[model samples]
Target: MQRSSTEGPSQYPHCLSSGRTQEAHLIRKGEDMENENKKSIKERVALRNSLVKEALAEFLGTFLLILFGVGSVAQTVLSRGSMGDPLTIHIGFTLAVTMAVYVAGGVSGAHINPAVSLAMCVLGRLSLCKFPVYAVCQFLGAFIGAAAVYGLYYDAFLDYTGGVLTVTGPNATAHIFSSYPGKHLSILNGFIDQVIGTGALLLCILAILDNKNKGAPKGIEPLMIGLIIMVIGVSMGLNCGYPVNPARDLGPRLFTAIAGWGTEVFSAGSHWWWIPVAGPLVGGMVGAVIYVLFIELHHVDPQKTPEEENSMKDKYEMIAMS
Candidate 1:
């Protein structure tokens, strides 16, 4: 049949519209199927135990911390300081801390250090019951991280030490895994150094997290904390190498003891094994208490003061008139 010009235009557009409508419907159907598949996978794999999930996060976070931090030290020591310097160790730890926090902060707050966990508990930021579990996971993670570094650098270790590991003297490699006091440092001085260093750490952390006191900008807390660690390591690392975290020190120490260095890692620094553990625990609490007394307690009420309230009211009235 011959069609009028108007009828042909109208029918052509209707066919085009029908085709477009079918295309849209097909697209929507495909999207719906994809979404359903994603939902099914999530339902099957999602963790049900909150505690276990958090523990795994803490474990992995601490593992990453020790892996890089100790790996840096190993490189420097094995290369006889030719590859990297003391500053390299500090920078490595800074990056390690920052990255670890980013990896686990959402789930476990990345308390890779037992001292930090205990401090959070004491400050009421973390539950007291969770502290033990978090601490244990952190320790285990550090232990595994140390093992990884040791295995990775096993050839370097043999080359550096000639297959003999000692805790002290020219070829001692124990300090690569754990902290040891300098020759000039006394046991008492080492303990004091750890306390001061860890106290400063906790003090700065509490200040950073206090919103009323103007906490760090969102998404930068991990970086800030990492920088704080760098500062502490540079400024206070002379004595006992600033092992402010019990898990950071002990886990690697235990690993070294088992791996090859024997028990001397614990006994070398005048039986200094306990100072890093006890000092940080005490110092963290002290720092948290100090922050609460000096700054946290002094925050003004969130409610607006009468003078500010009247100022706001006057501004509203001025806006209405304008």
Candidate 2:
């Protein structure tokens, strides 16, 4: 009938109960601390400023775009057309646009190109005040991206150029970073080429984003936008490599100007630097006009609710009668 002191739980019920209570208390305390830590982290990690977040997204997006594009050009030129080709550059740009959009679309609408941002501002989709911020971030991103490519291909560049950086020679590597008009290309024609290429770009972009019209599906807009770049490259790239994006061209061009190609990058092609910058800006406006006049304005308004349908019935009847 008597039990030993070391009989365990049966001999010391109260002590066992106390131990269990302590263990439960400690577990609950740990859980509470963990929950508090999680809450603190959740609150601290969120970015509250929309403009700053959007600018960062644009910067990253443009950086990726230029990185892949210029990297492809460097590969092709430095390899003596063995590793890649013009088609390879086109595909590189296409994938670059797609990847950049996927990265930045949710935050900043993925306007990796300043021309697109300018077009959005003109169309009232983006505010005028934010245009400069977006443009600055994009240009900075592209400049840094070009620098990265140059750093990556520094040895190849030296071998190809024999340490001589020229803008208009067989060893010219400046075109690897930016667009250059063909030998026979007139500055006027270069301007026209950019205008048409960028014009088509914005027109298709507007169509792709138009929900009222036959827009791209919810998740694949980025890829469609990419194909537009490829289309432009194949059709309009001959003259000036289809530098449809002002930031895309000028950012890398500025980088080349500073990174040993000298001011000749700006002064070459008959001082052709301004064409890519000004041409795309003008082309964006033109494309917006064309889309608004031809496609967006013609979109038929659809009623979303029963009340809306009823309200629009009378208007439809009147239009039908007219």
Candidate 3:
């Protein structure tokens, strides 16, 4: 009879208490989920912004690259009253590419050229999603840069031995831009040159970018890349125009056609155009494969730790700055 006081209503109160506690726990979990969602959204937004910035950097970098590279050609051609010496063109392009790389290397990896981007993609160094974005930006930048060159050299265009602003004329074809090589060199020869030239160029690029390479100094990647370009230009400019990068040749080549060089741009009468596009791509793949097999696949020296690598990078950066 005395225990009856603890029964009935008290039991109901206990049940209500347990239900309230369960509801509170669920509300807390919901709040946590909301906070987590907010954090994810912020991260996504930040990543999106970063990608946009990188793309813009790429656009600007490529614009400058084409401007200087093709602009140099216009200057030499107009000033000297000739297409200028081939060696001069070679040297001019070499320096131009080097300078562009140095200026934009940090921002956009200094790809500046579509072929380089493509090669990076094939080598697994660059994401496939970024390939089209980089290529399109590079192509547009080339056209704009070419337009700037045309504006600067308007008077020179008039004096050009080739017809000015005409896309399809005999004089314009040879003087203003490249034409299919005469006498029809064997495809094998052209292919060989392109493979060798591009392979060498890609090899140099890999070497410079490899953190494990004792000789590769950080910040000096651009200089080394530039020097390699110069050497290639000097050594192979004549043989195949040494367009080891597809973007270097095609982007500017397309602009040249649009700026009045004409349809002949695609005319590799003997299928020569394929050489430039195919050679560099294949050679780059081969080079990347070789690098992975020979250098990256091998085990790293235990002594060469991340701290050592960082130190090396710092030293290189200091050297570059100096």
Candidate that would win on TM-score: 2
lDDT of 3 at 217: 72
Candidates' C-alpha lDDT: 0.90, 0.92, 0.70
**Which one is best on lDDT?**
2
RMSD of 3: 13.8
**Candidate 2 residue spans exceeding 4 A from truth:** 1-7, 13-21, 303-322
Cα error, residue 87 of model 2, in Å, equals: 0.9
Against the true structure, what is each candidate's TM-score? Answer: 0.87, 0.89, 0.70
Q: Write the per-residue lDDT of candidate 3 for residues 166-193, one digit (tens) a residue.
A: 5344434323333244354677877787
Which regions in candidate 3 have their CA more than 4 angstroms from the true location?
Answer: 1-48, 81-84, 162-184, 302-322
Which window of ten consecutive residues has the lowest lDDT sum in model 1?
Answer: 2-11
Error of model 2, residue 279, in angstroms: 0.3
TM-score of 1: 0.87
- Tens-digit lDDT track for model 2 on 1-322? 8977787768879998999999999999999999999999988997899999999999999999999988999999999999999999999999999999999999999999888999889889999999999999999999999999999999999999999999986788899988888889998888888888889999999999899988999999999999999999888888889888888989999999888999999888899999999999999889988999998888778758988888799889999999
- Clash list (residue pairs), candidate 1: none
